[model samples]
Target: MTLHRFKTCATSFLAPFILAGVLAGVLAGLSACSGNEGANYEYDYPTVSSDKFQRQRLEELEGGDETVFGELSIGGPKKRGGAAAGEGFATVNYYLWRATLETLSLGPLESADPFGGVIITDWFTLEEEPGSQYRVTAYILGRQLRTDNIKIALYVRPKGTGKAKMDPHRASAVAEAKLENVILSKARTIRATQFK
Candidate 1:
């Protein structure tokens, strides 16, 4: 029974990793198949468009419905969700990302991950409001500069000298809302100034 349980646990733990490896192998095979145009010693296959009889036959069979206008694409069709083979996957709005950094300049930045769209600020206290300390964390979810795509979290605690139980960092909705407004406003201003 113990051996069986261990087998089950081990299988469950490693199943996801094995599946991921298989997926990566398949994707690599697909990408390798797409770049064959540059391969050396490759045989040139004839398409229907290259042959006179086949092109005329195909046109007659399809009744000219297959005639595609504009530039012909050799690559996969463009669609939403997921990146193509060569395009970089950048989902965060640059305006909101820059604005978050600028708005949180009052506090020392702890960590910023551009690709992950996360910004964490160290705890800081304003000279004007010494009674409270604030820490800010911002998340930019997508490429769009919409209010719903950005989130701000503000933690506040009383400025205490010694370790105090009551002065623990508490999440403040009001502070978060205010910070969100400020960040969005700054992002809009930056977008207007830069894009114009």
Candidate 2:
């Protein structure tokens, strides 16, 4: 074959493979660039407009009565049972959470886990005794607002000029028990009022 014809033949033979390689590379680049954009796309349910959903929720809550918006519903067994069941499933016991907070009001809260039902408080020092501080950890054991459903751990340490370490001997069981009693009492009071 002539040199010009040979060159043209070679070009035509290799063109399709080169074009395929370039197309594959472009597709790979586009996919890498779009990171996780389509991973959470839900095809089953159409997205609701936030403003319209909020307006509908407000109308349901208002229920054509401005004065009764904030009032707790009171009536026969059917009304009370459904509301109570719905509230129970949605979250942990509110009374126990409130009582725990109220009891630990003096201490600085470090971490509160609503899902795991754990509350940790930072070191709290008494005004009269600056040399000592206390830390508390409260655990909400169950959804029911019962005394056994709540647990507390109290740690006491003697404050030095440097970092204070907990002394096991200085820890008072009576003080911890007293605090637990107080929390349980408050929880009981809150539960009573809630049922009424």
Candidate maximizing lDDT: 1
* TM per prediction: 0.53, 0.49
Model 1: pairs clashing at backbone N, Cα or C within 3 Å: none
- Each prediction's RMSD to truth: 21.0, 13.3
Residue pair clashes in candidate 2: none
lDDT of each: 0.71, 0.68
Residue 99, model 2: Cα distance from true site in angstroms: 0.6
Cα distance off (Å), candidate 2, residue 179: 1.0
Q: Runs in model 2 with CA error above 4 Å?
A: 1-91, 163-170, 194-196
lDDT of 2 at 28: 100
